[model samples]
Target: MPYLAHIGPIAAIVAGVLILVMPRLLNYIVALYLILDGATRLLR
Candidate 1:
């Protein structure tokens, strides 16, 4: 649970850096993020 709290910000930071490097990946990154977030919440 404690580690779960850190997953979000870390994911966001990584996503942000990725988007910056490849603007075209913005959509995919966002979609993946949303899907992962949803799955994690559901599991909890």
Candidate 2:
């Protein structure tokens, strides 16, 4: 539970790096981030 608090910032950082490395993956990364964010919020 404590580690779950860090997931958002960590995921954002990873997504940002992935986007910078492969611009074409922007869409997928954003979508996946959104889905995960929504799922986490819903679960909470």
> Per-residue CA lDDT of candidate 1, range 1-44, in tens?
67877777888899999999999999999998998788777767
User: Cα RMSD to native, each candidate?
Assistant: 1.1, 0.8
- Deviation in Å, model 1, residue 36 alpha carbon: 1.7
Give a tens-digit lDDT track for model 2, residues 1-44.
67667778889999999999999999999999999888777766
> Candidate 1: which pairs clash?
none
Candidate 2 achieves a global lDDT of 0.89
Off by over 4 Å in 2: none
Each candidate's TM vs. the true structure?
0.81, 0.88
Top-lDDT candidate index: 2
